[model samples]
Target chain A: MSVRLAITALAIGLALVFPFIAPNDYYLSVMALVYVNALAALGLNLTAGYTGQLNLAHGGFVAIGAYTVGLLTVDYGTPFWIAFALSGVVAAGLGFFVGLLSLRLKGHYFAIFTLCVGSVITLLIEKWDSLTHGVVGVIGIPAPPGLGPIRFDTSIGQYYLVLAFLLLGLFVMRRIVDSLVGRTFVAIRNSEDLAEALGIDLMRNKILAFVISTFYAGVSGALYAGYVRFLGPDIAGVSRTFDLLSASVLGGLGTLTGPVVGTIIVAWLTQYLQFLQDYRMVVFGPLLILALILFPRGIVGSLELWAARRKAMAEPRAPQAAPLAGASENA
Target chain B: MVIFFQQVLNGLTVGSVYALVALGLTLVYGILHVPNFSHGALYMIGAYAAFFAVNSLGANYWLAMLAAAAVAAIMGVVSERLVFARLKDAPPMHDMIAAIALLLFFEAAVQAYWGAEFHRLAPPFPQIVRAFSLTAPAQRLLIIAAAFGLMLALHLFLNRTWIGSTIIATAQNRQGAALVGIDPAFVSTLTFAISGAIAGVAAVLFAPINLISPTMGDLVITKAFVIIILGGMGSVGGAILGGLIIGFAESFGAFYISTDYKDIIAFALLILILSLRPQGLFPQGAR
Candidate 1:
């Protein structure tokens, strides 16, 4: 546990030092974007990867958080810290209720319901003109105060702020995976029927995943709103959902570092391929086709498998970790 | 009272489109056993196909619809053969990821061609209906009628036709159906085509009432998912009933419960149903 804690602290310290090393605004900005996206993707990985549920509603939760900040900060002139914390709580609450639904559904049924919640949330954000300002979007979010009254108005300042959040989020997520409840989550994800029979309450554990994931998403959305200073319904659109889903898939679902690495590559590809402009996502079809064709385990899953093999060969493995143990034999 | 009646009628109109969309979802789920997230993208493609038919091909509205259905069916068969066929034996998650990719691809395709803007779309149908009150736009009426008619046709086709029955038989039990001389390959392909055709017809009917856009199908697709879930995974009648129920919910919800949260009605109901009956509203055994 101390080893994990030290490694995480080192990672966060390194992340804080990163933008200083970049020496350029463009690189710094892109790095910041990756950090924020990875944080959100990490949250998604908990639900989609650990629980074997794809909640497309992640984008919506982010939107909820972002808009909360956008509305409170921009419309009503609330400060950044208070607004950000509020957004996180709101997202978590919504997630808990959404998770309550997940208790009954398995696989695609959960995906379907989450997709519905996400879309409806978007539509409401778009149509609730009195509050959200309709499709015109919430704009003019203020920057946070920095060291000695300085503000994170610059891209680099914002970049570091995002990095701090991202690293903290990653550490928290890793801790979750290490905890007893985390074990229960993995168990339930493997087989709800079995997990439930073993006294792991279905409604409580799954909702915890939902709430945690939603909290990450909301915080990310708040970061996005503050950084870009504009928030719209399309941020909760299927395309965004697809991007996050693919990021997790491409990075290797369920791996701690997988989402961070995958998001960096995919996010960069999205921008890099933006030069191709119109046909960018059109190629995404073939890319996904290729990914599925070649690496169905995903890049991370394949890497994990390779790592396991190497570890096995090196040690002759005392006892291998059980596969899908939580949901084990219940199905 | 008239307003209430009007809301009911409107809800039914939109709900039928959802029904049609759910039918596509249910058909593929019955045969292939995966939720087709890309079905929404395909639904959008159907609208775009119709857009191309009328705008570029100079076909009449009616003919353009048929062309759209034909083209959509072709796309479905191509997808089943090209991607889904390969994914048949893969884990269900793999299939879902693949569908999401297709969704991203098709949506991007529409964005590239049409740009991200919405089109008012001059649907071929004329606007006026003879009755002043208690009347729907002719295009909406066509949607409702066509939805019911298509459903009827499907029901009859499945019951009466050899091939349709073969598909249903395969759905019941693939191994047993094969044992009875029904080729699973043929049934799967046929089911995919019919599902695509259903979506195609739905798009044409919906184009006039709603703006036709590349991203148009997603909202309806989510609702379609709810309908399919409420109706039961593979039950055709369930899809129809589920769609209609959602329609009434949305219509009345919009009027009574704030239009901003009308869609929440369907989702709230989805959670309610799942907690009560995880198998769906019209489970196979229940029916």
Candidate 2:
């Protein structure tokens, strides 16, 4: 706990000081993007990582959040906070709707269903041009109003704003994962039959995870709209979902800190690997494949794994590895 | 109602393409239990192969199609052997990630080599024919005819061949098939090859009408997935029905409704099916 607190302090310190270190707005915005995606990925980690439900519809939820905020603020003239809160709520509502329909389906079936949902969302955004402005997207979205004299219109302000939400999201995720609800998710992930036989309400728990994750994705999307100040149908595209999945998997599935680490690594690689230009994805593809195969747990996941192994070695006759063997089979 | 007939004809043309693609997806998923997201990339590769054969190598359409199928089949086998074979027992998500990886690699490779522009392959039989108050291009008729031929061949291959029976046995119960002296690994590789070839044929058939692009696979793959889910996962007959349903829905929906919402029809069909008959049109238990 002390180590975790110390790490958290260190992370906060770095984030607070990051703007000064960044050379320009481009880098600062990238940092902002990193935070936004990390928050969103944390949400995704809840479903895909912890709950063992592969939802490609996350990008769609993000889009819904962005569009909601965009529509609310741009057209209705609602305050940013209200819009933000509403966006998450709306996304969660839709998440519940999608989950209610899809959660009963097993494995790849659920995944495909989510994929269809994502595509439909994109299509709706595209076709419902009058509201979303079609491919033109919703642009010129106002920046969040400043708290008193502190204007959030600047890149540093946006960075801090994104960082604050990311921290909050991480905190909430930590709380949930450490609780009974999280255990239920893990139970479901490990085995539905076993979880069912144990009298766990599969439907309710799955829906909760879905709603919570979508809420996070929704908030992330709202943050994205605020940061980027433009919204488009492409935001919900499968490619973005692919990035999230790759990052989550790269960081490690089901680990609390995995998404953040994975996002940072993946975002940095994609952002900084401009020298390769179009060939970056060529490199990215194989890199992701290797990451999924070799370090399926991700950077933080692998680190925790190494630490556990070392501790196990020191303890000598510890039988902890036995249950994990079964858990990993589910993962 | 000539317009309705024309739309039906159009739907059938497009539906045949969907059926072909879905056939490949159903085969891979049925036998190997791999969703094989890269199947679309293979379909795209098939189109590109035929394009290369026709434009670059001076082959006719038929030869180009055969060449496309052969090339795609080889790639399918290689991909399975290298990437998918190791993931036989891994979680479904791993296979999904691997499929995405293959998709990314193939799309990038295709873009690197062919550039991102859409390439067209003119139909060999471009002449229009009028029959029963409906005028249609000969290429459209050819598509339907070819689909029927392929479907017929697949039915025969599955029903009348020893290897086909082995494939079925493996799909039914891998351990049982192995206990009965059938090789699961060989079946997996064979399934991949056959699936790839079918995708190649679909791509070749559709190339004249839709043109070819690296990103085309993404859309078609998504639609094929919808078809698979609608028809019921791992059922060949379900795939055919699902494909035709999608084709007709898109045709009728686009005509009656808005063109923009045509894609939404598939999603609606999927959701409706999940709500009404979550087991799909042809449940695996029935087989």
Candidate 3:
């Protein structure tokens, strides 16, 4: 626990100083994007990673959140903060609707249903020209409003604002994962039948996880809209959801730190490979396949397994029967 | 009345193609139990292969389709060997992720190679056909005829051939088939090859009617998912019926309702059907 705390502290410390050390405003903006993506991925992790409901519509929720904020601020002239709060509410409402309908589905059915839902969302955004500007996209979204002297017009200011939200999102995620509800989610993930046998309200719990997950995606999208100052139908594209999935899987799906680490790594890798242009995904696709093959548990999950194995090796010898029992239980 | 007939003709043309694509998806899903998202990419690749055959290799339409089927069959086998085969023991999501990765890789590679510009395959049957009050392009009629012909061939192949029976046996019960001395690995490879070939043929047949682009498979794949779900996953007959249902829905919906939301009809139907009957219109194990 201390080691984990130390690592967290060091990481947070680095994040705090990152803006100053970044090469330019571009890097700061990219970092802000990273933070925003991490927030969304964390949301995805709650339902998909811990809850074991592979949501292919997460990007749709993000799009909903972004559009909510974009429309409220740009069209309705609402304040950024109010629009942001409403974004979460609107997205969560849609999430509830989708969850109530689709949560009954198991495995691939749920994933495919959500994939269709995601496409529907994008289609609506694209075709609803009078409302969503169609394919023209929502433009000139204002930066998050500042409180008093904390102006957010500058990239640094915007970066700090996004960072703050990311921290808050992380803290909330930590609390949720450590709570009873979080355990219920993990229980569901492990075995729905077993969890139901234990008297868990499967539908209610699944919906709750999904709603919270979508809420996180919503807020993350609102932040993205504010940070990027542009919103398009492509924001809700299936590719975005895949990006979150990759990050979560690469870092460690069920772990809290996995999303952030994975998003950072992916975002940075994307930035570094910018020169490759269209070839980036060509390279990335195979890389993702190789990563899954090499470390099915993801980098963090594999590391944790390694650490556990090392500790088991160092421990005093136990009875042969005891080791066999432990192995079965773990499996 | 003529307009309705025209729409029916259009729907059947598109529906036949959907059935072809969905049939391939359902077969692979039966054996692998993974929603191979890359199926669409393979379809796109097949279209490009045919395009290349005609444009670069001077192959005729039929020869180009054969080339596409051959190329895509090899790709399907290679992908199964390299990616899906390795992740067989991993979580189901891993299969999905790998498929999605393959999709991204294929799309990007195609874009890089083909420059993302839309290409039109020359229509072999550009003549207009008129029946009673309804007039239709010969290509549309050909698409329906060819798609049904291919489907009929597939049905025979699945039922009459030894390897086809092995594929079915594996789909029905992997362990049971293994117990009966069938190799699951070989079935998987064979299923993938067949699936790829079906997708390839569908693409070649359909691409001439519509422009072919790197992303042409996106909508087709999504609709294919809807069909498989509506028809019941892994059910061959269900896929065909579901494809026709959706194809008709889109065609009729576009004519009667808003064209802007024609695509939404499939998704809307998906939500409604899943909510009412999550098991789909067909029972499981209807293969």
Q: Give the per-residue lDDT of model 1 (tens digit) for B1-287.
A: 67876897888898899999999889888887878888887788888888888888888888878887987888888888888888877667778888878877888888888888887658566775757466556887788899999999999999999878887888888899989888888788888889988998899888877888877877787788889888888888899999999999989888988876786788888878887887887778222
Chain A fold similarity by TM-score, each prediction: 0.89, 0.94, 0.96
Q: Write the per-residue lDDT of candidate 1 for residues A171-277, one digit (tens) a residue.
A: 79889988897888778767777888999887777888888999999998888888888887789876677778787888888778778878988877877787768
For candidate 2 chain B, the 10 contiguous residues with the lowest summed lDDT are: B278-287
DockQ rank order = 3, 2, 1
Q: State TM-scores per candidate.
A: 0.90, 0.96, 0.98
Report model 1's TM-score to 2 decimal places. 0.90
- iRMSD (1 decimal) for each model: 1.9, 1.4, 0.8
Which of the numbered candidates is closest to the native, going by highest DockQ? 3
User: Can you tell me the DockQ of model 1?
Assistant: 0.61
Per-residue CA lDDT of model 2 for B1-287, tens digit only, reads 89888899989988989989999998888788888899999999999999999999999999999999998998899889988887766677888988988898889888989999989998889899988777999998999999979988998898799999888898889999999899999999999999999999999998898879999898789999989887777788888888888999999999999888888898888888888877777776322
- List runs of model 2 lying over 4 Å from the truth: A316-331, B285-287
Two-way DockQ contest, 1 vs 3, winner: 3
Q: What is the lDDT for B157 in model 3?
A: 92
Q: What TM-score does chain B alone reach in each candidate, compared with the true chain B? A: 0.95, 0.97, 0.97
Order the candidates by TM-score, highest first — what do you get? 3, 2, 1
After superposition, candidate 1 runs with Cα above 4 Å error: A1-23, A147-151, A316-331, B1-9, B120-138, B252-265, B268-279, B285-287
